[model samples]
Target: MSDIAAPRSSSRARNLKGGGRNRSGQTNFELYSWLFMRLSGLALVVLVLGHLFTNLMLGDGINGLDFAFVAGKWASPLWQVWDLLMLWLAMLHGTNGMRTIINDYAEKDQTRFWLKALLLTASIVIVVLGTLVIFTFDPCLDPHSTLSVCQ
Candidate 1:
């Protein structure tokens, strides 16, 4: 039998030459968002694992986790800031990933715009509320927990 060459993928060949070029110049937003996703994901790996290790492994494990534990953690400004960073990074990372999905799948321009707007608004609210809770939390609020150290 005569040797034959493998068939090539014409679609991929065309795409390699910028076959999908759009009607406008490319924006850097997607590039930056993609980079952010990778970097934030990496940082989250460390932050989340460290948090788990401290709260669940370094101490009495899960049994040590309670309202008082949380209060005690938050009482230290360092831990509070760490939690705040985690909250912001997670929300932003997840929201950006969702935005990429919506941009990919949404058909109508108006629909995409509205959905993204809502997502942004909700993210903002949650981030603000979570940050406020972290900084403004009072461990002495509960009457039954008067023996707590914060009281």
Candidate 2:
């Protein structure tokens, strides 16, 4: 063996200068976040595929899409729930990914904090608005409506 001692292990090297173990008392938030990203990503794939197939492959296809088409689709509670889940999951999944990016690239604590705050605010607003639109959509908003649902 050489006279020089081997380098310290990474975990030991990160210890406090006073030889004390550096325990930050942090919880498993990162672990849960990672798990959520994976689960939501899988869920989003299924949801998006279902949504695309339903909207594009069924009925008259893309040519049939219009305000009336949307009205008909949203009239069903099943479609409403499907779209709502898609909206929420997509927003949350995207937000989580952005949060990870912010944590990785943002150098200053204040910048990170503000970026996260903005992200949260924007996400909440989008989710709330999307949910409201999905649930409270008025398909018969037109004053002159002869559609069966309007009757």
Candidate 3:
């Protein structure tokens, strides 16, 4: 039998040359994204823990929760800022994580494009609405408001 060599596929050849050429030439985009993920994750842990401690461990704890409780909390600029940071960080972190997953799993370019578009739209809407609610929230806005806390 004569010795024979198998031909290398184009993909195998590309792999041998290192996969750096396939990038879209965005300088340090992935590096920034990776750093953001780590920093945001750490911030989220601290924010979430503080939020839980305040809501679930202070005062009457779970029994103290109600509309009036929320109104009182939002009345303070400190609490409002804390909650706003938590909301924005959580939403952005989740959106970025989902985008990474879509890029990894969605094989079709069209599918990936649409998925990311939808994700961005949803993230924007939620962030905008949440921000508005946090800033515009007024417990005493309505003169006819029935809430005892509002009075």
Q: Model 1: how far is 128 from its true place, Å?
A: 0.6
For residues 53-111, could you state the per-residue lDDT of candidate 3 as single tens digits? 99999999999998778898897889999999999999989999999999999999999
Looking at candidate 3, the ten consecutive residues that score lowest on lDDT are: 18-27
TM-scores for all candidates: the values are 0.73, 0.78, 0.76
**Greater-lDDT candidate between 1 and 3:** 3
Global lDDT of each model?
Answer: 0.85, 0.87, 0.87
Instruction: Count clashing pairs, candidate 2.
Output: 0
Candidate 1 lDDT tens digits, 64-124: 9888888889879889888999999999999998899999999999999999999999999
TM-score, candidate number 3: 0.76
lDDT at residue 118 of model 1 (Cα atoms): 96
Clashing pairs in 2: none
